[model samples]
Target: MAESRSKLVIVGIGDDGLAGMTESARRIVAEAEVILGAPAMLSLLDGLSGRKEALEPDMPAALRQVREALASQRAVLVSGGDPLFYGVARYLCDRLGKDQFEVIPHVSSMQLAFARVKESWEDAYLTSLAGRPLEAVVDRIRTAEKVGLFSSDEHPPNRLARALLDRGIDYFRAYVCENLGSPDERVTQAELTDLASMDFDPLNVLILIRKPNRPDQASRAGRHRLFGNPDDMFAQTLPKRGLITQAEVRSIALAQLDIRPDSVVWDIGAGSGSVAIEAAQLAYQGMVYAVEPEPADVALIEANAESFGVPNVRPVPGRAPEVLASLPDPDAIFVGGTGRQVVLVLRSAYARLCPGGRMAVNVVTIDGLATALETLKNLTSEVQVWNISIARGIEQMDRVRFEAINPTFLLAVTKTPDVSD
Candidate 1:
């Protein structure tokens, strides 16, 4: 009768091989009657009496050897990094059974790559190109702040870079970490265009960190809406971030403004410049002034402006009413809010609005809305009022959730031509 097989041991090896493995892994390899691993991994086993077996190209062939060896001999299989992390161990365990294997994990190359780059991986979008389709990978990477990919021979760093570039996803800085845990280890950092034009070792980990405040380098296909982008798409000021004009209300307010190609617009209390930036897109031939009191918010406005590639938007730092003096009288104006002085700011801003120009105000509180209504009514007999309540759909698991945005009111009025002397 054949001897009963004990559990097969799967040890994760690194580029450094034997010297880098733990004592337990070394001892397990020493005692094994049959060992299986890639040619490079098997070459690391020195001074061992165990029968070394090179892995077959296919999983079934490798499984046959493991099963046959385990019947009369102790079996060991080696893989690079954590065997279950986009490695061979997962397939073997899934094909056979969990009870048949003991897995000893090593640091995955993705983890090592991020460590080499000195960046955090907690929020990174990580995956292996060895199994994923390149098109799917690029789509996932479009909005990611950081990404890590295990580059395979078929989809090496250069090939993957070309794929990204062809799709116009060029906003990230790329790092290719090669031969991790080995003396010949090299980390090459460059722009995606440079990476696409260069070559790299097949044994490499590719990492990408998105540039600050960058919008998608290329436009999404079928995306025709030029304004009122989702709120998260814009860079906002912290602590008071939710102050952004909601996309729904922004669209409505912009419509009310009746902006023209040469319309000079003002976004008072710009609050990270969402309104100002979109308005700038509308008035590309014109100019949009983004006014804010907070210095930090002003910085965000500038960053957001450049990120959106709208040089026409100007971020003016100072409170409204006072700063309004420096700006050219606007053909259109959007008042996000001006604290307790919403009424006061509106009065001053309306005074400078061009004849037949339009102005829109966004107010969140009922009391503030009331104050705006009275103020605007005094300025013009005609006012357009809208109560905007929005909820974004968020799908989790199989169920869907509607995230409600705070309901807000918009007051828009046109400065009557006769009254505008």
Candidate 2:
């Protein structure tokens, strides 16, 4: 028979410490023969006697201490705020199994921060900068009406605010709430730019609320239209000006994509981000990733996405195939510029596409079309090809004249479902 494990109580304490804890929670801590928590959190309960084990930030060492303490004595683990809200209690529960422990949660610091700002955080984007890369989150912040951030020692409020400013995001009013529920608690509010240059206490939550009725900071001379906006509406760089997929072709490809409000789409070689921006608007509740290699095109993609007020579009500045690996698998993919790596990109994309996902590739040259059709046909039997030839009526001196644009080929494929199904 297996040895019975001692019951562990994980108690969440606030800055007020013992005073903030409930009578039941205080009793549990008082009866514990061993207690584990951060050194600072342990210091708050100096009045209660127990064998105190300092919980290190290193998770492995902390878990080792937890196991040793629980094996020999009645253990009570102390954490800050709600033990599960980005707290140590989550890790303990996962490692030790939820059935082995009881959790007593206090109010989280994030909750207190939101309260201090008098803002509703139900719809706000909440995240922490402890282990997550800052780059992965900055784009999400660009479109959020409100955001709550738990600042780490390495990525403090000032550094985060500066990072936001550098990305052309300056519409949010910043609030740094420091030392919540403590004697030195302070709340500082300012513009994001101003917040970037200031310092704050190490223990703080940074809240950002967008400026009232503020339009996107990026230029928006072009009118915002749904799918099928004219090609000239986008700000494309010279030399690559004529390379954009014609408006008509884009409209057809989008239809074939069968995009939904929550579909994840990819616009590979997304020059000036025209297609990606439009797709983002279509997938309003979803995400669109624009992958481009040239530095200039990447900048244009970002500018265009912002101008269209589509915060869902993320401009990934890198080549396809390789960069596609990092992104979430797509529900729909549009390949615009292949750089003669059409086969490689198609195969990689087809492999990563979710079941029943759609892929649309446009090619202007016969050789390119042949390769695309052959490649797509290998992925699934449901392949379609369209020859798009569009002309606009231009008023001549005496009559309306039709100006023909170059013909393009669009090939679409839907991934095959499981045969067993």
Winner by lDDT: 2
lDDT of 1: 0.84
TM-score for all models, in order of appearance = 0.52, 0.53
Q: After TM-score superposition, what is the CA distance of residue 396 in candidate 2 from its true location, in Å? A: 39
lDDT of 2 by residue, 1-421 (tens): 9787787788999887888889999998988898899987898898788888888777767777887876755899999888888888766775556777788999999999999989989999988777544654575687789999989888898898888888788889999999889888999999887888899988899999998887664433236678999898888999988789888899999999999866789999998988998898788667899999999999998888767778778899889788987786678999998887889999999887867789999999999999999888887876899988988999999999999999999999988765653
> After best superposition, candidate 1 residue 171: deviation in angstroms?
0.6
Which candidate should be chosen as best, given TM-score against the real structure? 2
Global lDDT of each model? 0.84, 0.85
Q: In candidate 2, how many clashes are counted?
A: 0
Off by over 4 Å in 1: 1-3, 217-421
lDDT of 2: 0.85
**Candidate 2 TM-score, true structure as reference:** 0.53
lDDT of 1 by residue, 327-394 (tens): 76688999986887877899999988877799999989999999999999998899999999988899
